[model samples]
Target: MDQFTINLLFVGASFAIYIGIAIWARAGSTSEFYAAGRGVHPVTNGMATAADWMSAASFLSMAGLIAFVGYDNSAYLMGWTGGYVLLALLLAPYLRKFGKFTVSEFIGDRFYSPTARLVAVICLIICSVTYVIGQMTGVGVAFGRFLEVDNTTGLLIGAVIVFAYAVFGGMKGVTYTQVAQYIVLILAYTIPAIFISLQLTGNPIPGLGLFGTDLASGEPLLQKLDQIVTELGFNQYTAHDGDTLNLVLFTLSLMIGTAGLPHVIMRFFTVPRVADARWSAGWALVFIALLYLTAPAVGAMARLNITQQFWPNGTDAQAVSLEQIETDPAYDWMATWQQTGMLGWEDLNGDGLIQYYNDASPDMQERAAAEGWEGNELNNFNRDILVLANPEIANLPSWVIGLIAAGGLAAALSTAAGLLLAISSAVSHDLMKGQLTPNISEKGELLSARIAMAVAIAVATWLGLNPPGFAAQTVALAFGLAASSIFPVLMMGIFTKVNNKGAVAGMLAGLLLTLLYIFLHKGWFFIPGTNSFTDAEPLLFGIKSTSFGAVGALVNFAVAFAVSKTTTPIPARIEDLVESVRIPRGAGAAAADH
Candidate 1:
């Protein structure tokens, strides 16, 4: 079959499975809609959580970021995975024992303040909405590539699919759908890596192949990669080149953000017991690690493959000629991707040969002067395209390429649905029922949830068309907001007897400060041309806006402690609530709420 037909068949098949699961597990009540009736198995919830957590950022863009930046980008890997440790240890079990349907609900009840709940709801919406933008953008990119449509159209189609499952089936449908998505995405990701690993290092395991010997050069894969990249005027692949302080802070921000993200935290609420929540987190990490461990290998090998493709003779040899790029079947992938405008090349200096090297490197400048080259020809290679194009670069089978198309869509759509659910629940459950319309019926709340989800999807789709960065970077901003505003409050609420006044003050302080810092660098309200400064030179102690979340979180803790000390202590009842959440013994009884 043709590539388009194969892509359609695979993607359509995966969507069919998701829709089927949604139908079979359609949610009937508010409890089911919000928390999957609190009946999900630990293993099933783990798989669903893995699929929900591993969004386009993890599945599509992370490896690509690592491919270009090398060791400096290891922050994403360490930060994301390490955060799960915090979740499993510090948050999941306690939150699950609290027996609430949403993170904001827990925060509101724990603080014993409607104002506190309102603050939590606002924070949840901000982070969740920011997050969904990345997912929508990922959906656009995936659908655009596979269906041969524009990004706008792809995003709309993806939004519709997400709406059908999320609005109709709610948490129950989303859970089962995510389980299936996890399977499709994992198989699709690993299959290409296995093929490429065998071709490059004669090793079937991509993770092992990354450190194993390269069959071509009889040297370690990383060593060979280092040599090739440096010879092409790029930094060595294994060296750390970014600011040390920024790297540490960025990683910490991602970790805190991971623990604080409402959608991820909500997954724990779906389990049957506190013990199940703990075990579910462990299983989620196991599933996440499968991809995380293999990602660096995918990045390293794909980098090596692309470099070799450009300089088939060697870096010291002449670069690939434009004539060959246009005519060679081996180079057809470039033409295919170029149609998306995410990949491009130009015969700069009218040399006709594609000098795909780092023009910023001094050594490359000297070489370019000698060779009559003006600048780098590979000027528009979007990092987001790396994984999606990897199978094609390695000449993998058509079926495998089609599988990747499905996988990318699954990754994007699964996370989108999860984020939409979080947003909807925050609106329908936390904001409306908990505060605004406390008397709203269950049927009314369900209808509101569906409406809220649709609105969120629309907003996300609109923002995605004008995204601020690649999928992962944009998502990192959401993580920053969550880490700053939500994580500190949640942690304090569970671990201490902080009063409502303190919680409210801390959340607002963190949320406002983080938003201001991000806007100063990224743009006012993230509108394209409104920024006064760039992240390249942030105003705050040389820390980039994206890395400022850790500082904001610390600010939150300090403010909360100071504010609480001067104000009233936690009430006796609230204190008892706090003490009760610390133990997991009553979890089975808690599950009876549904």
Candidate 2:
């Protein structure tokens, strides 16, 4: 079959499987919709959580970020993975033991105030909405290329797909569909890496192949990549030239943000017991490790492949001619990606050849003048396209490319479903049912949840068209927002005697401060170029807008503590409640008593 037909078939099959699972497991009551009746086994919930956590950011954009920036982008890997560890180790078991349907619920009860619950709800919605925007961006990119449509059209289609399943299944349907999605995405990710590893380094395992000698050059894979990219006026593939403090802070922000993600937290609420929650967290970590370990290798190898393609004979030799790019089957991926408006090159100087060296590089300036070159012609490479385009870059089989089409969508949709559920649950359960209309029936609440999810999908689809950044960067901003606003509040609510006043104050303070910082650097999302940041100094001085989350967390903790000390202390009953949650023995029974 033709590549497009194969892609359609593979994607259609995956969608059928997802919608079928959603129909079979459609939620009936609030419990089923919100927590799957709290009956999901630890291992099952773990795999589902893995799929939920590994959104388009992880699946489509993480490796791409690493590929171009080299070791400097390792913060994404370490921070996201370590943040999961923090969530699992420090938060999940306690939240599950608390027996709340949403994080906002836990905050309200634990803080002994309905206003605290409302504030928590606001935080959850903001984090979730921001997060879904990133997922939709990935969805748009994946669907755009696979379906041969523009990003706006791709986003609309993806929104419809998500609305069909997510609005129907709620958490119950999303959990099971995510399990199937996990299998598809893992295979989609690793299979290509395995094929490329074997082809380039004579090793089938991509991770091992990374450190192994390249079969073509007989040099260490990273060593050869570094030499080639530097010779092409790019930095060494393994060098870390970014500010140390900012990288540390950015990694910390991602970790903190992971701790507060309501969708991932909601997964724990599906398991039956606190012990099961811990076990699921462990299993999710194991599943996540598979993608995490493979990512570095995928980035390095793909970078090497593209660099070699541009300088076929070597960096010292003549650049590939435009005529070859037009007629060569090997360059078909470029044409395909160009249709998405993501990958493009312009012949600025009317040269028959397209030289892709960094024209702005001081070392390349003399060479550019010597060759009468205007500048770099390959000017429009979006980092987010690297992974989805990887199979094509290596000229893999049509089936492999087809598998990726399905896998990338699975990655985006799974997380999007989970986030939309979180957003809907916050609106229906926390806002409408819990606070506004306490007498609402389960049936009414369920309908409200579906309606809320549909609305969220519409908003996310619109935002995806003009995303603040690349898939992963947009996600990092969400994380920073969550980290600043949500993580600190949850930690204090569980571990400290912070009063309701303190909790509300901390959330508002952190959120506003972080948002201001992001607005200054990111030009407040849609207006892209208004920000002062540039490629030479990506951060302000040394810090990025994304790195400010850790600072926000510190401010939150300080403000909450300060306000709590001055205000009325937690009543004796609330103190007892905090004590009960902390104690392990009879923790499950304590949850029941509450």
Candidate 3:
């Protein structure tokens, strides 16, 4: 069968499974809609959390960024994976023991203030909405490429599918569907890496193959890659060349953001017990690590593969002739991806050859002058395209390519569903039922949840049509918001005797400051021409807006403490609630209290 048909088959089959699971696990009540009726097994919840946490950015764009930036990008790997440790250790069990349907509920009740819950709902909405835009964009890109549709149409199709599962099944449906998604995404990701690893390093494990000797060159795989890329005027793959402070801050931001994200936190509430929440986090990491550990290997190996393909003989040889690219089946992936305007080349010197290398290097400039080359020909290789194109680049079977298409869609849709659920629950449960309409019926609450989800999807799709940045970068902004606003308040609510006034003040400070910083640098509301400063000229202490979340979080902590010192103490009942959540004992009773 042709590639298009195979892609449809795989992607279609995966969607069918998700829809079926949603039907089977359709939520019957507000409890099922919001918390999966609190009956999910630990292992099952863990897999679901992995699928929910690892969005399109993790599956589609992260390795690609690592591939282009090398060791300097290792922070993404460490920050994202390490955040789960913080979650498992500090947040998950305690939150689970609190037995709330939403994170905002916990914050509101803990602080004994509807205003605090409302602030949390706003933060959750901002963070979830920002994060969902990235996922919607990913869905658009994946659907556009594989289904041969325009991005807007592809986005609509994806939105429809997500609406079907998310609205019908709620958290119950999303959880079971995410388990299926995790299976598809992991298999699609690893199978290609395994094949590429075996071909390049005589090892089946991509992680080991990344460090193992290259079979042809008899040198460490990374050493060979560093030598080849440097020969082509690119930086060494093993060197760290980015600003050290920004790197540290960015990593810390992602870690804290991961722990604080409402969507991931909500997953813990679905499991049966506080102990289950803890174990579920560990299992989630195990599933997440399967891809996380292999990602660097995929990035390094794919970079090497692309470099080798460009220079068939060696970097010293003449560039690949343009005629070869036009006529050779090996170069077909470029032509295919060029349709998306993401990968392209031009014969800049009219030499009828393609030179793919770093054009910004001074040494490369001198060599180009000596060789009568005008400029680099590969002018627009988008980082997001790397993983989706990996199987095609390696000439893998048509089925593997199809599987990858399915996997990318799964990754995008699962996270979109998860984020939408968080947004909906915050609006319906926390904002409306908890505060505005306390007498609302359970059926009315479920209806409101569905309506909130539909609105959130529409908003996300609209923003995705004109995304401010790539999938991962936009997601990073969401993380920054969460890191600054939600995570700190939760920690204080659980660990400290922070009063309602203090919690309210801290959330507003963190949320406003972080959003202000992001808007100034990333464009006002992420519109293209509204920004006063670029990331290269960050206004705050050489700290890029992307890395400012950690600082914002610190400001939240300090200000909350200072504000609390001047305020009244926590009420006796709220203190008892805090003490109750700190221990796993009587979690069953606590869960039943609401």
lDDT of 3 at 182: 99
Model 1 regions lying over 4 Å from their true place:
none
Query: Which run of 10 residues does model 1 get worst, by summed lDDT?
Result: 585-594
Local accuracy of candidate 2 as per-residue lDDT tens digits, 384-447: 8999999999999999999999999999999999999999999999999989899988899999
Q: Report the lDDT of model 2 for residue 345.
A: 97
lDDT tens digits, residue span 424-517, model 3: 9999998889888999999999999999999999999999998989899999999999999999999999999989999999989988999999
Q: Between which residue pairs do clashes occur in model 1?
A: none
Q: Is candidate 1 or candidate 2 better by lDDT?
A: 1
RMSD of 3: 0.8
Pick the winner on TM-score between candidates 2 and 3: 3
Q: What is the TM-score of each candidate against the true structure?
A: 0.99, 0.97, 0.99
Candidate 3, which segments miss by more than 4 Å at Cα? none
Q: Model 2: clashing residue pairs?
A: none
If ranked by TM-score, best first, what sequence of candidates would result?
A: 3, 1, 2
Q: How much RMSD separates candidate 1 from the native structure?
A: 0.9
Instruction: Give per-residue lDDT, candidate 3, residue 134.
Output: 92
